[model samples]
Target: MTAESDPWAAHARRTVGGPRPLLTEALELLGRPRRRVALDLGCGAGNDTLALLERGWTVTALDGSAGALALVQERAGVHRTRLTPLEAGFHQVPRRRYTLVYASLSLPFTPPARWDRTWRAVRRAVGVRGWFAATLFGPRDGWAGEPDMSFITAQALRERLDGFEPVVLREWEGEIRLAAGGLHPSHTLTVIARRLSR
Candidate 1:
């Protein structure tokens, strides 16, 4: 899709700043790793991808929008060699293990019909003792009933992370400004979990 018509492109343009706080926290939890391979799932404008690259992690920036991938490449500069841009939807995510699987605000956009499979793939992608950090929308979010989007409850989220050890699982609700430019009621569940086994 053209950058003008792509919502992700606009989002990338608007969110052009530092890496996400959850990501920073996850990194701190992981300390220094022996292998620095990471997957930036739904990696919009490469905010987290750039952060991973800067820290010497080989990152695969996955996104569905060509415009978003282009922006990632443009911003990668010297880090481009360590960055691999994959153009595909969430359902098509590769089932390969990585030292880190970081999905910022991307999991909420996965369609309900595809969530189970997508999530399973995501879970499998995390290597043993690897980190998985993501933000999922709760049922009270403004976009909760958008048909295609998936929203979860605290209990459900905990159930989903059954095999993983939770490092950070915080839930909060409030009015927040949207990237598209409007105040909206949002309930978010931020999680940083580590795969303990298989």
Candidate 2:
């Protein structure tokens, strides 16, 4: 696919920024005092990865694009020692435990056929009382039915959060202006839940 047609490329170009607001808010709400190991799933451009590193967390930033991973590594600069950049798609996430498993605006991009396994992998990667923060697309999202993507309703989402004690579960819908000067509607569920003791 062409650069414009590839969602990962498009997002990498526009991912310049500090930590996402949702991430910052989630951390504030959790109030966890210790630095934790983090897995930044689909870490496009490393915005969230940088945030985690700044807070003294060891981070494994994984993405499907080699270019994206390169950018993340470059952004890590002197802190590269704490950042482990890996090139892998959703289905290839390695088996590992983490104190924080974060996926921001990326989980929905998992191909439908592999989503079940990916979800299971995601859950298994979290350590006891660890945090899981992510942005999941809702059924009303403009990309709801896009191929290779997944969207869930509020009720279904609740069912999936069974092992996580919710710290923040917020739903939002609005129009987002694209870099192409077009508008796209978005409906998303932002979650910041702590895993229950297992």
Candidate 3:
């Protein structure tokens, strides 16, 4: 199937599972003013991008697919004033200071060799006391064996998240349909962290 047929289009079809129940707690972290800027890394058609915008955060939507960006632009409507859809590779994307950085299920696509650089990029891009939420593929994910994909064991990932205090670290063991429409019930790991003080 062609890129137009990527099954991820379906995943994007689904809404964010639920409003972040921890949002109030997160908001309390802000001393006075609310966060104004946010980044949706690997924003994949801007599903979460839309969610963030709805909450009044100006968003920079980044995705590797032109098609995805197009869809985002269309869905966002007048919110376009607050949205900047970037079509580019993760490596080419510059580090910008943002209050929240969300990667969803997309960072797993970053090649393993580039994982360290990309991880550091994410850490450096967000502002002091910023928030980060993402899903990482565990070593046991079926795709872990894929030569070019990045998958880390929970231990390794925990180590990578060393400095940040995790607000949520959850795991799932089940079949996950791929972006290509194939099914692989595998191990999935998700983490949401926040920079505290530093």
Quick one: best TM-score, which candidate? 1
Candidate 3: misplaced stretches above 4 Å? Answer: 1-33, 177-182
**Structure candidate 1, residue pairs in collision:** none
Candidate 2 C-alpha lDDT tens digits along 47-148: 999988888889999998877787788888888999998888776777887888899998999988899888888988888888899999999999888998
C-alpha lDDT of all candidate models, in order: 0.91, 0.85, 0.73
Poorest stretch of ten by lDDT in candidate 2? 1-10
Among residues 3 or more apart in sequence or in different chains, the pairs in candidate 3 whose N, CA or C atoms overlap within 3 Å are 175-185
- Candidate 3 per-residue lDDT over residues 40-145, each given as its tens digit: 8887767677767787889998887766777788888878899988876665556678887777667889887887888888887767778877777888887778
Per-prediction count of colliding residue pairs?
A: 0, 0, 1
The predicted structure with the larger TM-score, 2 or 3, is 2
Whole-model alpha-carbon lDDT for candidate 1: 0.91
In angstroms, the error of model 2 at 141 is: 0.7
Deviation in Å, model 2, residue 51 alpha carbon = 1.3
Ranking by lDDT: 1, 2, 3
Report clash pairs, candidate 2. none
- Write candidate 1's Cα lDDT for 1-198 as tens digits: 765688788788877888989889999999999999999989987889999999999999999888889999999999999999999988777878999999989988999999999998899899998999999999999998999999999999999998899989999999998777889999999999999999
